[model samples]
Target chain A: MGLPVSQILLVTGFLLILIGIWGILAHRNILRIIIGFSLIDTGIHVVMVATGYVTGGTAPIIDAALGKADAAANAVDPIPSALVVTAIVIGFSVTAIMLSFAIRLYDAKKTLDIDAITDSKW
Target chain B: MKRVCAILAVLMFAAMFLGLVQAYSERQARSPLAEYYLTQVPRELGAPNVVTGILITYRGFDTLGEVAVLFMVAAAVGVLLGSKKEQRAKTSSTDGKGPSELVRTGAEVILPLIFLFGAYVIMNGHLSAGGGFQGGAVVASGVMLLILAMPASKLDHGFLSVTESLAGVLYVSIGILGIIIADGFLDSHVLPLGKFGTLLSAGAIPLISALLGIKVGAELSVVIDRFRS
Candidate 1:
């Protein structure tokens, strides 16, 4: 059995990362740049999770069919799924904090334009 | 100047590519510990997702550091942007109009379902695709809906703070429990592993996921409350 869906997801995730990178480079607004960063983070998470998918593999739980004696016969790798949870939480917190920064920047400068906020006199 | 920057970037990228190729060609075979970890960790940990096991158990110290980083960032943002005087000033000026009827109604209708789905994701973390992060995000989204639908002044700050602190403390305590009760730090097998695919089977993963959900929800709510318009 081939994991065509997983492959597609991986490719799509890569495309999203590329698009997000482009957006980060091209956008002039700080908010859009932050959004691009979020997109890139999400794309990476998708790619990492997709890497763990095994064709015809069952969930990582121990199977009764194989019994306790040989429990490894059917499980797929559970590590990536667990790691992705931490990544997601980190990403959410980061995004929230970044958004807060964006709000503060907007408050200070009265502008969301990235070019307008540059100053060495801080 | 832009063209020069672009050319320099391309050259740097090419150099990195060459460096990566050289490194790959010269890399040694996997170590015995690496092979043992790859083969043995999943079976022993009873978690299907090796990454989850690594994050929550094997390298839990790193995960704790990551949470600290998040908390510090949040605190830094709060300190930098938040002032009692500024908050009071903004509140008076920006008693902004409430959310539209459509948004308010929609959010009210969907928030409970969203929260239930987040709980489901957290509870089934071991057996299914989701884990703490995904469930946490889902819970955060539920709070986001509430923030969008209601006034910031109306938000229950006390409840949010209690939930956040409780979750953070619980997460650390669970890690400590692993050290005290099990083989080492963040050893999830401290609790008895039930038959396997059941909700209670993964020892502490579901518990961690639940704590994560509450922490994320509180954090995101705090973030949203800070931005009133």
Candidate 2:
């Protein structure tokens, strides 16, 4: 058979990470760099989420659909799901902070180009 | 030169990932720790949603730190973008006219339902798939829709900060109560674990979820509003 669904997701996540690295290294605009950072964050989250998958398992909720007994066998990994949940919020917070810094930089330098703001470059 | 360097870096990453590809096969079973959470969360915490149980109760300290990080971001963003100078780079759609009539009407109709759904998601976190984070995002989305519809309207800082701080204080207070009453910090057993699969069940999980939802919603709304300046 072909690669499993989680592998496909993992590959996609890795590709996204590669693309994000390219964006960061190649792009000079501060906004694009922020976008690159966001892409990296998203890629990592996707990978984490994909790692949580079980072959034929369902969500980790303890409803009638997913009975309490042997719930571990029936459900996907709750830890990764939980960690990803927190990670997503952290990612949002970091992105907001990055954008805020970008805005302040743009205000002071009057340009979105990173190379143009070389005051701190040594 | 930058392009070549970028390609080289990407290739390096691809090589590294290729080395790890063998481990990416289908997962066969949960780890022992995952098994413990999947079983004990329901039995001890009485929260149906195992992930929610883990985040709110089992991993409560981490959640507190995460919330603190978010709180710090909101403050930092406000400090960064919130100056007295009154200079702002507008979103390029500025023809001096506000949002379209359709957008305004749609926001008016949908805002209440969005808030209602956010509350539902937060309250039903222990019972279902969503929790404070997702529901709080939904609530902030409603605020975003409002901001989109009325670009010139200003959010009240006084009200937003009050609500955010109140939720945060109450959340920590409940965590302390857990020390006094139950096992340890953020112990959900401070209150009785009412009934299985019911609204008021799951000890303090739903309460914590609601507090988290309100705090996150307010913090995010403040953060989103910060982009206005």
Who wins the TM-score comparison?
2
Model 1 regions more than 4 Å off: A1-11, A46-83, B1-43, B47-51, B84-97
Model 2 misplaced regions, further than 4 Å: B89-95
Docking class of 1: acceptable
Residue-level lDDT tens digits of model 2 in A8-67: 888888888988988899899999998999999999998998999999889899877889
Tell me the deviation in Å of residue B148 in model 2.
1.0
What interface root-mean-square deviation (Å) does model 1 yield? 6.0
lDDT of 1 by residue, B95-196 (tens): 657789999999888999999998888767666566666676688778777877775436676787788888999899888888898877677877877655
If candidate 1 were superposed on the true structure by all CA atoms, what would the RMSD be? Answer: 4.8
Kindly give the number of clashing pairs for every candidate.
13, 0
Instruction: Give per-residue CA lDDT, model 1, range A1-122, as digits (tens).
Output: 55365666676666666667666776789889888898889988987766665544455543344343333444444556656766876887688778877877776898999889779875
Q: Tens-digit lDDT track for model 2 on B72-163?
A: 99999988988843446454345578889999999999999999999999999999999999999999999999999998788998899999
